[model samples]
Target: MGELMGRAVQRVSHEHREMAAERLRAAAGDGLISIDELDRRLGTAFLAVTFADLDAVTVDLPPAPLEVVAAAASRRVLRLAVSNGSVSRFGEWEVPGEIELQLEHATSTLDFRVSEVPATGVHINVQAFRSRVRLLVLPGTYVDLGSLGRHRSTVADRHGRAGSSRELHAVRLTGDIRGGSLRVLRRPYQLF
Candidate 1:
């Protein structure tokens, strides 16, 4: 009876090992497991070949295709129009090539950076009071800021090269900025 019990335990252990191998193979094919990671996991399995050991292995499984889910979640577009107030403490805004912005009714401090803009156009119109607006533009891009008003405003093109592309992208900002601040950073691509 003792020998029989030992044999039964050995059989269960082998079954657990086989199950682990199968899971490892599936995970590898699914691109969830690198060969080195798989080897490490298998080594851990070999050290302890019981049901509880296998359960622990299953618990440590790497996430599956989470990038697609994350990208989908972070991708967004915003069109905001604020009126009859002062917008202060606006920070750097980066605009990617794929991003589209139509902003109007902004009143306050405005600081903006424009880089790597792949879009065909953008429209901005803003009004400010005792606020400073700054814009930085990249090379080979066009930006049209319609009617900007403020205590101080500066448009600087650091690319040092004349923009050869005559394709005018329009940004229209229309509002009143009274005693506040706004800053925007624009990138070549649309970012979340």
Candidate 2:
């Protein structure tokens, strides 16, 4: 844990920098910065290599809670292995840093509309053979498709709310599929 914290402070990833850029965009949207300022900060954010560098991008903006940042940074991964059945998660479930789903002849649905998302992000790893999986995320959620091998996949709203606002959390989907289907859908945030 100490080591991870140390590393996080020293090295910044592209994702981290992008997150900072998103924050800057959001600040601009909130009338906190001018367009020229936004562009300049975005350029610096993209080139940021350390946590401090990323922090500098949003230093003038209102600070997010420390607990939120810590919780986002310290989330654990959730793993699910199933065969020949159906599994679903919805309604106020706690989302982990990552979800690894291994399926065989099964079906799964993960609905994030009513789920609790950590401050960082959620990663879904779908490893399936002869199965089906569906992921539902809210309107503000960002979905990044990473490495995918085989199978039929459909992602609605592939480019979501980009540059409009900051995405405090995201759902990253990756993995391999064989003779299976995977679908990612976006739904409006519900008040009910």
Candidate 3:
């Protein structure tokens, strides 16, 4: 994406960079780009400050089919509801594009160390009280807590590196987390 209506080019977010990086990685995997080219584009993607900068990362690649994009966007959101116990997801499991966590006096673990994350990234809308939600993500995954609203709750994020990886995706945390805790843990090494 570039300048619109002769207006200023938009600034890029973690999601934009991650999406561009995914495209570059896919191009490399499909033999459309060399490892060196992929590395160069990934570096650009992570360092991109503007949408124009991110656009350059995959300007040479083809656009995703509109139908495929719509399908991905329309994927149903996963709801993880708990009230008095725990729910754990680890090992190899399919990760959805979005999740709405409903918890009360409960605890849950969403482990993304080994999973097929969508290229578009994931959104987590949380609603909790007297609960604990733990997220175990890969080292390179980008987690944004800007939209999270917390009261009497603490969020511990342990996986924020200065830069990102091309193979990783973005995760945004939103909604309210009350009288509880949201802990984000990063696995030092990937399982897959």
Candidate 4:
């Protein structure tokens, strides 16, 4: 076993690939790159194996803002791993700016009704298999369901599109969920 392989490459994780895809999507939405360019980069991103391979996709984009760099430095990220059965995040829990979820053969409930979600928005990178994901959102909360994915899944979005809102998105769903479903519900308005 002495045959030496080429220089070792630190393989990129699922979360990293999804994050890069999200960045490309955002860049396209912000008019930073053309749709054709976005399509080309997305293809490269999905097929990327190493960190350098993925990095090449977003290499030309401008770096993230200084404030975002600071926020990342402060470590506002959440990672959840669950297998089988159901999972829920509700009842005034701390909602961070970035979330990574790994679900296997499970049902997930993400209720944002009674939580103090970040105004800047939340970027969720999910890697699911044979699972159902339900998101409970309220009115006036911008939701972006248009993100990159490579899965055999279905999404039943009841919240519909954002109407006349200047905000980009209050919650942006990214990543892939294979052989399952994504259902979004708009919680009724409450004046309590």
* Between candidates 1 and 4, the lDDT winner: 4
Assess candidate 3 and give its lDDT: 0.76
- Give the per-residue Cα lDDT of candidate 4 at 1: 22
Candidate 3 residue spans exceeding 4 A from truth: 1-74, 162-168, 189-192
Off by over 4 Å in 2: 1-75, 152-167, 189-192
Query: What is candidate 1's lDDT per residue for 1-192, written digit by digit as tens?
Result: 987556445522443454465566568778887989888877877776455565566566654243332232224333333455444323445432222222233443333333222223334444444444444343344444334444334443344343423254333444534454444444443344
- For model 2, where is the 10-residue window of minimal lDDT? 159-168
- My TM-score estimates for the predictions, one after another, are 0.27, 0.55, 0.60, 0.57
Compose the digit string of candidate 4's lDDT tens values, residues 1-192: 222222225665554566677778778988999999999999999888887787789888876543443353225788887899787897667777778878999988888878766545677888989998888888667777777374788887765775432253368878998998888888763645
Ten-residue stretch with the least lDDT total in model 1: 95-104
The TM-score of predicted model 1 comes to 0.27
C-alpha lDDT of candidate 4 relative to the true structure: 0.74
Per-residue accuracy of model 3 over 16-86 as CA lDDT, tens digit each: 56667767777787899999988988998899888778777777798855334424443648888989998
Query: What digit string (tens of lDDT, one per residue) describes model 2 on residues 71-125?
Result: 4444466789899998889776767767889999999998888766656667678
Output the better candidate (1/4) by TM-score: 4
